[model samples]
Target: MNQTQILVIGRHPEILATVIRLVNNNPAWNATGCITDEEAMSTFDKQTFAMVLLGGGIEEPSEDKLCAYFTSRNPDIKIVQHYGGGSGLLSAEIYEALE
Candidate 1:
C-alpha cells in the first residue's frame, strides 16, 4: 500500500512526537517529525511529502521559509497549521487538506 507521507514540523519536541504518533496511527498515513528548521528541511529534501502539518510553537519566520521551500519544491503540496487540538481535529484537518 502506498501511504501518504506527512512532514510534521514543530518547535516543541513533545508536541512534534505526539503529532507524529497520532498521524502514524492511521494505516494510510506516515509522518516524519522534525523539531528544527534544519532538520525539517533535511528530512523534507530526502523524502517526498504529500502534506505538511505545521504544529504549534513554530516561529513565523521559520514557517514562512518552510512554506516557501515546500511550495518551490511542490507547488501543489498541502500545508496545514495545526495548533492545540485533539487527534480528531488533526485528522479532520488532514482530511480536509487532502480534498
Candidate 2:
C-alpha cells in the first residue's frame, strides 16, 4: 500500500510539536512539519503529498497564498486547516467539502 503523506504548516512551536507528535503516531499519515508558508510551498512543489494541514492561526497573507498556491498546483490535494487552540474546534467543513 502507498503510504499517505501530509505537510503541516504552523508557527507555534508548542502547537507544531504537538501536531508532529500526533501525526507521527498516526498510521495513516507520513507527516512532515514546516514553520512557514514558504517552506511549505517549497516542499510541496518538489513532491506529491496527500494532504496539507494549514495552521489557521497563522498570518493572513501567508495562509492565503499557500492555500491559493496549493489549490492552483494540485486541486485534488486535501487541506485540513488547523485553527490552533482547541482540538474540538477544528473544522471538518473544509474536509467534507473537499470530499
TM-score for each predicted model, relative to the true structure: 0.97, 0.79
Writing each residue's lDDT as its tens digit, candidate 2 over 1-99 gives 565677888898778878766666646457688997778889999889878888757888887788899999999888777776553343343335336
lDDT of 1 at 16: 83
Superposition TM-score, candidate 1 onto the true structure: 0.97
Can you write out model 1's per-residue Cα lDDT over 3-99, one digit (the tens) per residue?
9999999888888888899999999999999988999888989999999999989889999999999899999999999996799999999999998
Q: Mark the regions of model 2 whose C-alpha exceeds 4 Å error after superposition.
A: 85-99
What residue pairs are clashing in model 1? none
